[model samples]
Target chain A: MAKKLLTTLTLMASMTAGAAFAGGHIEGAIKARQGQMQLYAHYLGILGGMARGNADYDAAAAQAAADNLLAVASLNAGSLWPQGSDMDSAEGTRAKAAIWENFPDVGAKSMALTSAAANMATAAGTDLDALRAAMGDLGGTCGACHKAYRGR
Target chain B: MAKKLLTTLTLMASMTAGAAFAGGHIEGAIKARQGQMQLYAHYLGILGGMARGNADYDAAAAQAAADNLLAVASLNAGSLWPQGSDMDSAEGTRAKAAIWENFPDVGAKSMALTSAAANMATAAGTDLDALRAAMGDLGGTCGACHKAYRGR
Candidate 1:
């Protein structure tokens, strides 16, 4: 019984330590969120090229990129942004303090991107003109969020 | 006819330039793929903590992490592996030349990860025991690929 109790105590101690580590290590969260943004950029770049006629519009590739964009955009990424990990506190990140200050607004703005991405995904595989039309809405969401929440 | 032919020539030149840029400017590919790896690590960290009993097993969080892992693992990421972006050629990547040399093998290895992640996604939300069982397979796939294709 004593041994079992000791083991339980150790596990509890380790769990507490883990929680502390998770709370403090915002660097990992910062890097992970930035990586997620890179994915957004990559998929967006593909669709943007096709929209601008800089690259030929392949239906399959367009669909794939748009689908990927929607998948990442739809993620519940709240875990990636803990308090005190904004531009003022963290290095190597452009996420502004306004993100935490204006939480619901930031969330709503992100939802706009998700909605735009859903529309883009539906239209991208259809045709170039359809993709072109959807691109405007999608791009606008990205720009709005960056302008409001990302530090230059 | 003459003006149309000139327009065609201009488009062709731009297309060729775009292809050349895609083939040569491998820095973006390196960064993008590395970012992808970062995502895999992040999602895996979430599940790993629960599997190791370092974090309490929340069914929802586990499911979300597993689903995200499967999503990224299933991406058609061939474009991210442009030939010249290996460890020896790229500055900020640990992808080894073996990856290029053994393309089919690398592809097969990646498929294993996808397969494992799919199973993990199914099992993770079920229970802690199920998540623990799935984690071993998922972690093994990661280790196998890193052992063969990732550089030190």
Candidate 2:
């Protein structure tokens, strides 16, 4: 859990620095994707805090965050991942070339996130225990994709 | 409309540079709010394109973007606007201290965005004309808030 928090913090820090290193050509795309990721992290950060007892659980807040997560997950974001916008090609992104190479595999991974977010959207405001359970699935999906597609 | 697009392009550019101007203390709060604004822009950009015939109007795409806009607007974002996190106190943020001073006024302005977004969510997928009509309301709400609380 500590490691996960650390990773989240690290990701946020890098995201902040990313704007400074924007690639000249596809800078818009990079910023758009990074912004999406930041929103995901923002909502997840809220739920994670409640699940871990770092913050008191407010059902309305939890539900809103979960819904935001699902909405973002459902966005038609294909335009934000144009070819040649990977980390190797872009200055500030951590998207790996493997993502472009993976094609439908990356698409499937994104679907998993959507599915997990949908479940959490249902579970988040119900109760603390339910939120904790759902967070496991959501967090696992996030970690799985980062392991496969994200670069350091 | 050209002027609006230009303003949006300028906003995106500023948001991209925002991360580079971290306010040191409230950077996390600043980034979170900026991310929310970017998400709003992203969805609005999609709907605006379709409305203006800049992009072919797909019902599914329009609905998804509108839903995302509503979800983002509905976020419980009170925490992202801590006292002393406005433009006067934080770098990279256009949020004016007037927002903090306005109390429920700022809250009401935000609620206006939510209502407009909800209407857009219902209209966006119905037809181009419906989408265009709703966009006027949504865009007006955005402009009103920016004029009142956002700084250049």
Candidate 3:
């Protein structure tokens, strides 16, 4: 679809700043989780950008981005953010101690993301207004985790 | 599972170089596609590294990595790779003109990757030998694209 093509083009324009990762910061488990997060953010940004008119709206791209976000959200990160790989223990991540210290809350927050992402995936592929609303909910879910677990 | 934990630790040590992305250099469509590839490669590396004994084979990690790979590889890249966003137009990518010139072949190659990735997703979570075989087949599918469409 034309929307898909345009979305892909728009994403191409928006995703540039995310790829310049220094290639030496957090190498192991932390890196994997962070890399996954970067991947998630890029896709979400694409959908959210489109919804806000910050970028062009392409339905296909939005759906795909939402789907990608959903998949990452559902990934089994049980082994990724290991017990000791939080920012306090690692050098390159912003993940806080709360992710492990309160795994239940973190788990609940993660599920919220997955649920929001699912809504976005369906809404994104449908229409702009739906996409916008769904994206806000998903973004809120992300903020919930960052507010409690991500540190500056 | 212990091997998976150790592999994750070793991956942490070996993965430092991938995190050095500068954060400002590449910021558009090409970057999105490349980022997706980087994500794909990271997950594949986890599996391939395990298969080769270069890293410990943690069944859970391997399965999760494969699932992640399948998810990313199966993403709707429709907008991610736009017209004129090839390597010739982009600075940090290796996609060749043949991708557009031989669109059908490119489509086929992409589908091949999807098929292989699906197999990997199914095999990785089940057993080690299945993971190894599926990975080789998936690698071959990747090579098919590089052989026909990618540049050095």
Q: Estimate each model's TM-score.
A: 0.81, 0.70, 0.72
TM-score of chain B of each: 0.84, 0.82, 0.78
True contacts kept of each: 0.34, 0.31, 0.19
Model 3 off-target regions past 4 Å?
A1-28, A54-58, B1-26, B54-58
Better of 1 and 3 by DockQ: 1
- In order, the Cα lDDT scores of the candidates are 0.74, 0.71, 0.65
| lDDT of candidate 3 at residue A18, scale 0 to 100 | 18
Q: lDDT score, residue A139, model 1?
A: 93
Q: After superposition, how far is residue B13 of candidate 1 from its true place, in Å?
A: 23
Q: Model 2, B39-115: lDDT tens per residue?
A: 78767887887898876776765786787678667655554565667788767888898876675566666777888
The residue-level lDDT of candidate 1 at B114 comes to 81
Candidate 3 at residue B45, lDDT? 68
The candidates, ranked best first by DockQ, are 1, 2, 3
DockQ of each: 0.23, 0.20, 0.12
Q: Write the per-residue lDDT of candidate 3 for residues B22-106, one digit (tens) a residue.
A: 1231345566666666667667767877788776555656766777787777665454555555678667778886665665566
- Residue-level lDDT of model 2, residues A39-120, one tens digit each, is 7887788788789887677686677678878877766545456566789977888999897666556666677788899999
Candidate rank order under lDDT: 1, 2, 3
Q: Summarize candidate 1's per-residue lDDT along A10-46 as a digit string, tens digits.
A: 4334333445236534777688788788888878887
